[model samples]
Target: MAFRLRASLERRHLAIDIVSAIVGHVAKADRNFRHELITAFGEAFNNIVIHGYRDRTDGMLDVEAEFSTEQITLRLSDTGHEVDFAGLKPPDLDSLPEGGMGVFMIHALVDEVVYHSGTPNVLSLTKRTAAASENDGH
Candidate 1:
């Protein structure tokens, strides 16, 4: 299944809620998987709004979600300032920085993270569902 959402930064919650609802329906039996996916997605969305657009309310976010029986993938695209994803460094866990953990948390929670910087920057996150993990004898 696939779903798409286009929303302004001002009304970001609506987009998040709608996507969360879709995730809930698709991953009903796996609470942990649902939480991880949502959390990772939220972090990515926040980064786009906060860093990519620099908190500009007029900025827009284009989100696409795809689901299979064993995995879920989310792609977020924004026409904001391009990000130097290659230059991003993981947060220092020992120091526990106050506000720079979004990227770190996103990478930790999702199985895959891919970013492409361009006119419309894109960030893609994918994770295997619990069923997939169990099926693989993990």
Candidate 2:
């Protein structure tokens, strides 16, 4: 990672803007900032503002993003409620669920999503570049 950027954002609409800023940093890591990456970032931030804080205005959300020449890792931490990843099943689209797609989309867009819970809850999402994968392929 070149450098880590961390921000304690308010739990509100501006959360989207914060997410966009992170996406910009990911683009800076490599010129190829895919929409798939941005989509995942959006869902991650929405999860923080919505489920993480239970839509309460009293809590703050912290986002940390690391960018390197090959990949970007975004770690989101919140002091709010923690989610049990073991039970974090993808939404059943067959039922046309009105909600719960946010986490699913996040998982789909990123190369990996890991959950950590302690004093502060954490959800880390990572995406590797095509170039990086090409190196692995060899």
Q: What lDDT tens digits, residue by residue, belong to model 1 across residues 23-135?
A: 76564337777778788888787777777888456777777778776787888888888755442688777996797877777888888889998878888888887677788
Which window of ten consecutive residues has the lowest lDDT sum in model 1? 1-10
- Deviation (Å) of 56 in candidate 1: 4.1
- Cα RMSD for candidate 1? 2.7
What lDDT score belongs to each candidate, Candidate 1 first? 0.74, 0.66
Q: Whole-model lDDT for model 2 versus the true structure?
A: 0.66
lDDT of 2 by residue, 52-103 (tens): 6775666666667787667778777777677654336888999999987877
Off by over 4 Å in 2: 1-33, 85-88
**TM-score against truth, every candidate:** 0.81, 0.73
